[model samples]
Target: MNARRGPAWTNSITSTVRRVLAPLAGSGRGIFGTAALLLLLIASGYIGWAKWGDIIVRRPQYVLTADCIEITPQPPWIHSDIKSAVMRDGSLAELSVLDPDLTKRVVQAFELNPWVAEALSAVKRAGKTAPRVTVQLRYREPVIMVRTRDPRWKGDCFWPVDTEGVFLPPEEFSSTQTKAFLRVEAGNSLPAGAVGTSYGDAGVTGAALVAAALKPVWSSMGLEWIIVRQELPNDVGQPMEPTYILLPAGAPVDAVAARRSGRLVSLADPPADEPSLEVRWGHAPGREAPGEASAAEKVARLHQYVAANGRLDQLPPTTVVDLRPGAAGTAVATGRPAQTR
Candidate 1:
């Protein structure tokens, strides 16, 4: 009976120790998990703060100024004009402020340049300390040069004009540059500073149209220049007439006499010693004036005639080509036989 009691006592001691040890182990595991989760959240927040500080809070490296503005692909002659236009407002501070609206204004200033046909954009260059502005410009091309009287100048001088008859400033061109373009005599004049403006003058517009039509075959035709004349009516209440004439580089005396006697009326005071052929292009082409041929039709007819008959010089000296819309709306060439020398 004593031995049985001793075994029961030992069993009771073992059960008490197991119950106490199990609860202590579970509490230790829960505390460790909670501490690890808090540490992970703290590390994530520190990384996010560092990135935000670098992008938004740092000082910018560059500023806007006249020296920072760059215009490209424009000839040296026009550089002064471009610079003058940019600094006209006298506010470098306004340009330096980096903003979308300010960028748009800068682009507009460049576009207003008389020589610039288009201002593509004004944008900031990447990786610059102070942002530099780059401007892309498309310059206007001169199609024809005209000599007109300007009150600002001493006498009549030549100026370049585009296809739309917009006058370009002559101040920037050298004599060699001026002489390279085909000469056109508009027989009209415009006011001072007409560089950025266009004249809707019928004679000027008509001359431009004729020049464009002749461009493709101009070299082959041995043509030198074009003349636009406004003819007065012989009697009252008659509509004025516009005449188009083509002149060779150097015409002989006989050719001049022959042209004077042709079907087309001669200028009362024709430029002395100059000979020319009359195309009888009555009005500006593409204008769709009644009883007139379209520009394309006239060009096509001229091309076909030249292809069949050779250049204009090969034709009789007195020949007058009529490109107007006739009864059948076809071009016709008429003149007396070539005179024997």
Candidate 2:
């Protein structure tokens, strides 16, 4: 070993050259490395194509944007509806696949109704490449329905409740508009939507009882704005402050009264704290109370007493003929005109 130290640097260079050229000299392993890399690249491409191949089929789907939200009472033409508003726009046609935007346009129009409380629109697609779309609409119910005298409605009556029976939104009308609709029918003159529902009329009911039932409704309409409507319009509100109409003694006497009030108070009334219908009624003009009596009996007696003694014309500001007991609805008595019932 001590004798070999003289040529150490030259030997080290010779050893490095042999090691560096060893693979090129005769090893076949380099070809195996190239093959491994080629296989890796091929595997990656196959896996990627397998996972994402269906993306092209899903790309062309339809969508709907409406009212920026969902709505109710969807129109008949629209596919989405809350309750009865939902309907099928297709009628044995593959139209959605041919044209998606057309379906969206029709539904949009239905959503535009002022009565609609809310509206939602979206596109629905079917099939792989060419998708078909469908639409939907919702609507608002405006009138209150009551018993009808018609044969078709059977025995059920409708109450004029909104689609949800909640009050309508204030934005639907002007500040000056105050309208209340109450309907009872035995005929087919008005549409079901206008009156709140489609129902048959009740035939041959008593007159006074019907009047009593409708009395509350009529009173409510007149007092809606806390304004006095002398009379309802001939078709709506028209006359002075709200008035209590005298019935013509018919089956729907209360209805007639209601109609008159609606016409008289066509516009919102002036502010008033006390409700007009709640005003007190007094006993007829004269005849002192002989003794204690029940409310019903007292009313009957007062009618007799006024017929015999009191001259109603003699009373002041006695617009109504109060036949109610304890003079509950009697007008003021004046010393003049001779009180005759």
Candidate 3:
């Protein structure tokens, strides 16, 4: 009787356990099915995107044309030609295809151009049917014209150089652009025609500095030209040094005279054949010789002398004003009658 009672009790325990597990098994199956469906959907989307990605990139709605590009500080010359080149250079392949890396390449291409000093940015507008590509460009501005002797040319050739001594293409310049700048003669013998290249020569660089420094006073002072001549070594072991000369525009040397009283006398109507006064600007700005004043100091001294006296032409002709530091005084205007005052 006790064994029969134990079997009945075991059967009752098994039935209770089955009833508790049935619902849990069904829930597990449902969860597994949901996970499989999610994975399938993800795989299908990826496959579709991979197959149709190029199609989306090539869509007409996303294509960029010349009209879509914008340049800042609009250059004096036509920009449509440059826009065409940009488009041809794969800059406007497709809005979708232009990743960050490709966009950088496009910007570099524009920067490398001779016309552009800097390519600040290239951006594509998002969510637009006709996508626009905005390009920020800094154009190369010519500060001074350099007249150098090129072996390839029979005569002296002129090159438009920026303040950093970078050569710009002469063909790109219009007459108005060419005539507006002052000319620097550095006796640079380097070959020309390679636009966007710099001589990196010290003399050329110094000349550029002088030109930049004088720009403010150039027109005001009636200055016409700057001549940079490299002097021979003083001693056998010494290096060569540069000398700067400032020539007046249309004013002749003999037109202004130093009277016996040491006062400046300007001729009422000077002859056109008379030579212009030449100011001896000791050296270029940054390349001052040892024991010499800086270009800024020299310029200041020259201005002080001019203001104390009068216009540059008011000084005597053939006058050599030594502006170097420690030079006898602020300026020693030699080759002229001594000032009484």
State the TM-score for model 1.
0.61
Q: What is the Cα-based lDDT of residue 308 in candidate 2?
A: 50
User: 1-341, model 3: which lDDT tens digit per residue?
Assistant: 56544444345544654565466557777776566556655665566557765676667755556676766745664333666665676555544433445457668767767667788888867535565667888776667776666568886566777777787778766646655676666656453447777855555666677778777776666565666665556657575655666666554322322111121122332423344566656667766667877777777777777766666656665555566655545765655446724
TM-score between candidate 2 and the true structure: 0.26
- Model 2, total clashes: 71
* Pairs of residues clashing in candidate 1: 61-129, 62-129, 62-130, 63-130
TM-score of 3: 0.67
Q: Best-fitting candidate, measured by lDDT? A: 3
Please state every model's RMSD to the true fold in angstroms.
Answer: 17.3, 21.9, 14.9
Model with the higher lDDT, candidate 1 or 3? 3
What TM-score would each prediction reach against the true structure?
0.61, 0.26, 0.67
| lDDT of every predicted structure (CA atoms) | 0.61, 0.34, 0.61
Tens digits of lDDT, candidate 1, 1-341: 56545444345544554565466457777776566545544654465546553443333443356677777666644534665665674343444434546567777776666777777887777534566777787776666667665678785577777677767777767766765556666554442456767755666656777777777776586565566666556568564546566655454523443343322453343433443454555566665458667777877877776676667766665556667764445567666244421
